[model samples]
Target: MHEDEWGEPGGGAPSEEHRDRHELSPHQGSGEQEIEASLRPRKLDDFVGQPRVREQLQLVLHGALGRGEQPDHVLFAGPPGLGKTSLAMILASELSASIRVTSGPALERPGDLAAMLSNLAPGDVLFIDEIHRMARPAEEMLYLAMEDYRVDVVVGKGPGATSIPLDIAPFTLVGATTRSGSLTGPLRDRFGFTAHMEFYDSSELSEVIRRSARILGVDLREDGAEEISRRCRGTPRIANRLLRRVRDYAEVRSDGAVTREVARAALEVYDVDELGLDRLDRAVLGALARFFNGGPVGISTLAVAVGEEQTTIEEVCEPYLVRVGMLARTPRGRVATAAAWRHLGLVPPEHAVGAGTGVVVDTEPSLFEE
Candidate 1:
């Protein structure tokens, strides 16, 4: 898997024409690039939310630094934009170690991994993002290097082959993946600890927004931050992005002060509704209701129906809907529950029921029923 395979084209390549219509900007980095260049947390205490994970990571780094030993291999799993990469950098900073960053898809050949591993200083942190997408041969080479601090490079053809075992520095390997379940069992088991990042609550998001607003030197009223937080889709990255957009809107349209009204107006103008559903989100629901008859539709079909990628629907959009109690994943496929229909101002059919199959559809008024 190449970096392009992950759905983001590299270089200055122009976005495809079809994608241009949606106004979806290309992802520049793992969301860490912006943070690193601008707002990265310098210390663990500065990182907001996920207190338990932060504490555990702090202990790991402290113990390793105290003993002058390499920290154990660690895994961080979560949805995108949740600070996995940031945590990896923080680990390196805490250990007072040099850090090298790469992604699974970027290490295409075994030689690439070997080159990177061999150059690492003792106690350094080599952070691999999207670890599940690493090539098999490269992944195999990593196992030995991580376990024994050495790698065997085989040169030449079978008859004249020479195997050379080269020693590597005692560096810590930190792997981050959005889909940990897709990782091989051996790879998954090698990690000493795994941290699963969860969606931030509104309170946590508000804290993140407030912290970011301060860093960006934006004048944010308490109500303004709260309003922005409510529409952030429970992700720190989204919160930061929304903050930047709202700041721009405020700068041009208002007195350069971020207030509740300004935030609300900006978000509305950007097509993010009061409930935080964007145009694409409403399109997905509308397609389900109008075309699939409030389906139990397959993800692929739904994706095609809404003109978005399946992964986008599953990983990004569906999670929020599921979190808000509007969508349900059934054995058959995905179904719009009563809340979803009601959210769209549609009435559930007489036969429609909740995921439990016990609630009667008639109990809820449908816009279509009358």
Candidate 2:
């Protein structure tokens, strides 16, 4: 049997080392992947949030089952930590089919993708995460496989190579991407159905935390669940991660009961604020408000001020900041809103973008917009 990405044997239980490592830090490092997998809902009904997507997907899967055929290629696009990967697994489970998991980065060559396609059995589910990042050649090869269930296998070198058309087993392709816009139009169009995952609301995340608490055997009070949910940044993955951290603190610092007080104390120690703004998040806000004077500053300048990579500033910090009305993107550059100043306990300058209204009017496209 082949090894999974975590080095665990495929189709088998995780190794003892994985268990021990998970015990050590249930929410940190690569071990978190294993824990998250365990926490994922095996059935679609058990999955939290994105009700529209769930309803749409149920019909597709049921219709395909009635026809006794594999469902069409499905695409899941949204921000990370919203159960894309989990949904892919659930699709396989619903069909009672085997699933093979790989990421776009893993399929960098046409041959690499060809090998994966050739190995799939009929009705198998091939899940490719971060599909937008797949190599150009691999992506082109996939177009043919997705439409015709055939791949051109070239033998020998370059000009002397012979292109052999190999018919592969018909399988369902499930693609997940955080940046669907980066995907080619042809690739996007090929997907028979697309599910856009949304950020979990407070109530949904509280339910998620409760479910996870039961699974982890944590003595989490309702208030504790609510507290953790509020600070989880609207993502189930983050909710589970924070719950594990809170559990650790409860076991060590108290009688192991996670109440509101305990959760707050634990989060305070970990530097997560009321709005779920962590160290980096606050740092970005502080820099924007204090250093750049509620800036229309370029991302490079802001990144330098915060000593972070531009990509980190753009992808990680900017999205949430923009979402919560603390920042804005414009033709000029990034601008901190009036809320950012207030959050940092500073007064916004009169020249600030949203200073007059005290509300950030985002002219640029929102990160949460579908």
Candidate 3:
């Protein structure tokens, strides 16, 4: 999923070696990376939010450490920017092991995964982000490696192929995916622990903003932090990004002091409204409410109307919109909820699907209905 970019902290261009070509980070640059890394909590105790996840992880890590063995295969399923990456790093730190970071899309061939697996030291943490996207062959190879710590390396083709079992180090696997439902049953079952990351509440997000502001040395007031947090869509990454933008505006527009009014003004300039909806978000809602008259329109049609990719609208924008009760996915198509129309300052048609009636009205005309 693509996230909005904040202004690059350092002027240097992004380094290809440090990031995947397929994946897009919020901000990029060796210097910018360092700044982001600095903001991440190094220890489990230092991590904020997800109280249940933090406690469960501590128990798992401690139990393994006490037994003098590697921990079980862990799976983190959640939306982007809820600290899945951070928790993986923290797990490694807690175990005092080195972490090898890679993503599923990068492991196209079994050989690619094999090479990485072979090089891992015992007790190392192998973090595979977007694990659901891994190639089928590599994923099959991983099954054995994850279960038995051995991989069958095929040395030839067809009838001449010979499977050679190679033993790998006893390491831990940490797989993260935004779409847990896409994971195969066998793969999901292999994980000893699976943590689902939830969206933060306003209070939690406000705490995140305050913590981030301190780390970045921004002169922020509580009200300013709360304002930014409320508009961040319950994501810490967005909160940090918005905080930086507000800080920039405060420095140039005022005296480097971030207050509630300053934050509102900055977000207005950036086109983020109080409900955390941006231009694209509003565009989607507007198209549904105006063009389709609160549609049961197909996602494809909506994408064309908004000039956005189907995946972008489906993955990035739709989740929050649906969570906020502004959108609904129906068997027929996508429909705008009554709350959506009201949010856009438009009235919902009485015959609309989500017009606060118990029944669904077909907005589209039927040829048979004379």
Candidate 4:
């Protein structure tokens, strides 16, 4: 998160628009939105995956309801599409309250937050998506709201300023972030509960794909669902998207039924490999292996060779690769593991990383570069 003056965190919620406001990102298409919305679990009971999160959230909500008070502020941290947003919506739905949805970038000034906070109904849920990126001033405002349900709005300019204390309706704040580590110490400390969403394994992802298919009226065979699940990179959003794409392929190229082979072909056309390597993912690996001879090269150099941002390479591309054993991030730099070469359809050199060949490069590369 960039260090900037933050705005206050208050907003009005006349409707449930806040719950649906976070942008899904570049790969999220308009046509699938209806189906995606339809497929979202409305209640915690229906949510799939993240069993630990479900249990913790259930306890928090039930405890609050029993005490006849608003639930504590909740923080959900994980990569996109692991159901952080869905869980927020589910909490609101279960509580039978409306939710206001906004991202950190949307709340630019303290006044922006004050307007929203001043109008919330008691027991409402205000979800701040990508909250780690919120402006510094707004984040400061949120501290009081989360802890005390109060905000101090400064009226007038310069030396004539006056701090006006505003009492907001008791409401629940649900904050979601991909990088919880980036959150300020005070902000992170204010959360009553935090859930770390992990990637769904193949079985869970298969269940997710099958569930979406059932709702969308697609006839997906058991193995077909598994095939799609395996290539989804452990993300439900990608699994659903691939299922829709495979459904199209099935209808146009086959008998309108999703079989394992059909799923394979559809994903191949989409350029998603069995290892779930996309264009950018493969590019990072290719550059690391081919150009750098299996690496010890700096991340910046690898990003340069691939024409990508260093952060994108480190944050987005490298994590999955390292998780799946296809890449390794050494103190020296990024090294292509033996599995990476094999996945890219090349044999590992005798000098390959972890190959016990012991052929070191002329110069060891540092992560920060020269």
Candidate 5:
């Protein structure tokens, strides 16, 4: 087999030790690419959730089109699988402009970016995913292009170098980044519009599931869809994926229909619990609960215990855990809550601060009485 980006084997299961199931599908750009493309909501009208983003983007695009001017550079900042790429595609569609898809990592050098920028036709949309990862030189080149729609090409060596100013067609740059904080001030300042995508709620994710099921010809019951949505960790992509697996279970094990029981069973088989805790997620909580004893353990220590990258743990696992109140981050370190202990089938310590007196998860708190 050929070498991968990490200089490892390319044709098999990934060698990256801590790649969770959530990170596998869409993040890696492998198995779910085609399926995701099919399920993508083309127009803003067809899109679900992110009401504020949808409304603001509509106004921006309409205003630009009304004035017969190209739309300004737009930036989308959020976690993975939050429909940033889909929104970019939708932007191009609304403008009736062709889109050129590239990522920051793909644009390694000044010339690489210059080539793409110089060739763009006026009003075309250039989508750069993971814009924060772009090289310094490339980012510098982008500043001029975004402002002046021109690129300075330097030919020859040293003092003999001749700089040729090339006028590029005015194009819209649509950038998407998970780490907006990592972006330089100059780059962040370049985007005229920034859409901060939020996580989809259970209702929105349920709708996404039902719509996807209809498109994919999967017979999913309402309860089944709800089950998947609740356990999808507020992501449409995850909901769609769980539905596909549940559909397979339905076809192979029982009748060709996904019911609540079927959905539960299918998710259980894959280690996705009631609270949408996938394998890696559970591992993090389990470690915090059982191994570290509801720890104020460091993130790096936890990552080592779980065989994952510290960044992966911070970016992917910590957000959801914190959101659900399973884990708490203190100045000292990360600590598991009583809820986390109960989820992993462990009892919270009686002496644990903030855990309450004999506090039982899933049971309502009582003021008094035996």
Candidate 6:
């Protein structure tokens, strides 16, 4: 479904002005928590798309069950909101194993991870979200735990220390990260299998919308779901969010039925245009077009130009822009592609003289040289 729709009250019941006011706010750390709570997939079957990953995971779980052993460590890498956490939970459920969930940062010291490992029962799953952020000491402990089911804890500091070898129960470790490349090679290689998740296709997102709608008990027409899915940026989370908004639109504005017209109206009211570009998206493009003269601008410069955070520009906006071919990354920085210029109804200078164009111009000589 549409990115703007999720967690909205069903039916277009909210006043246009109210909706507009809400849409104008930033979508950073605030709204996402609510959206995530509302839309997280509760079951494996409900997790849309990533069929290959699903198949492989099912086999792993099944084999583990058949052999009465803990499944091997699994590493899931992808952009955010791709169901890595949900899949981890499902794996734990399938194995009927207790899951201890924590982020990399939570386990600050080797002792912290060692304690957690020591407490785990056999076949339990330890899910580490944002594993790339784990401290070096904790990561070192994890390597031994994963490889040999043991942790060596130093009893005291400095030269007086003696190492204590503590055995831990055989447990499965599931790691999730947005940037797998940042993980050390040793850490990366420790996982028995790595699953790289990709964005959902429109069809997959539509199914996600339909499924969510069914669960939420909203009457969503097929075309309406499809329309929302098309603008969901190939993300299941966005699709679920869009469904909620469209449902609100349908209920408040018209009959409590989500139709294509209702979906379009809801998205328009939310400042989500036809190309799935929200207000922030358009603002980024506008900044690149107007300020930088179709930008070969650095990310920080672009963020400053747009009055948005650099991380927001780089993570939330830039990836989609680059994916849709509206932006390109160059050795120098981010450059607005021709498509970006056209999308903003602007034209690049005919002879903009980009770096490495090999065109030379006369320059003034220094007085000392003369």
lDDT of 5 by residue, 1-370 (tens): 0101101111122222235334454556554455667788889999889999999999999999999998889999986667888899899999999999888888889999999988898899999988988989999999999999999988999999998999999999999987799999999998999999998999999898888889889998999988888997787666776778788888999898898999999989978899988888899988888787787777889999999878778867888889898988866678888788877887778644357886432323234311
What global local distance difference test value does model 1 have? 0.77
Best by lDDT: 3
All candidates: CA RMSD in angstroms? 6.2, 6.6, 5.1, 6.4, 7.5, 7.4
Global Cα lDDT for candidate 3: 0.83
Q: How close is candidate 3 to the true structure, as a TM-score?
A: 0.90
Give the clash count for model 6. 17
Report the lDDT of model 5 for residue 140: 95
Q: Tell me the spans in candidate 2 whose CA falls farther than 4 Å from its real position.
A: 1-33, 357-370
lDDT of 2 at 336: 83
Model 2 has an lDDT value of 0.82
Instruction: Evaluate model 1: give its TM-score.
Output: 0.86
**Candidate 3, poorest ten consecutive residues by summed lDDT:** 7-16
Model 1, 1-370: lDDT tens digits are 0111012111111222122223224574554345434665767898888898998988887887789778899899987667787788778888788999888888889999999998998888999988988989999999999899999898998799998999999988999987799999989988988999887888998988888888789999999999998887777776777787899999999998999999999999888777778887788888877788776777899999988888768765787787787777765667777777778889875445463456543333334421
Q: What are the per-residue Cα lDDT tens digits for candidate 6 across 1-370?
A: 2133222111221211122233425655456455555565656676678999998888887887799777889999987656777788778887888999888867789888988999999888999987988899999889999999999999988999999999999999999987899999999999988999998888888888887787678999998988898897777766776677778888888999988888999999977777788888888888877887765667788888878777767767878888898777765566666677777777655423332345422233334321
Please provide TM-scores, in order, for all candidate models, with all chains considered together.
0.86, 0.88, 0.90, 0.89, 0.88, 0.83
For each candidate, the alpha-carbon lDDT, in order, equals: 0.77, 0.82, 0.83, 0.81, 0.81, 0.76
Candidate 4, 1-370: lDDT as tens digits:
0100011122332111222244555555444355556888888888888999899999999999999988889999987667888888899999999999888878889999999999998999999988988889998998998889999999999999999999999999999887788999999998999999998999998888888888889999999998898887777767776787899999999998999999999889978899778877898888888898897888878889999777777766777788898887766778898788988889998877656688654454545653
After superposing candidate 6 on the true structure, give the runs of residues whose Cα lies further than 4 Å from its correct spot. Answer: 1-43, 347-370
Candidate 2 clashing pairs, residues 3+ apart or interchain: none
Task: Give lDDT: candidate 5, residue 351.
Answer: 40
Query: Which prediction has more favorable lDDT, 2 or 3?
Result: 3
Candidate 2, residue 165: the lDDT equals: 100
Q: What root-mean-square deviation over C-alphas does model 5 reach?
A: 7.5
* Higher-lDDT candidate of 2 and 4: 2
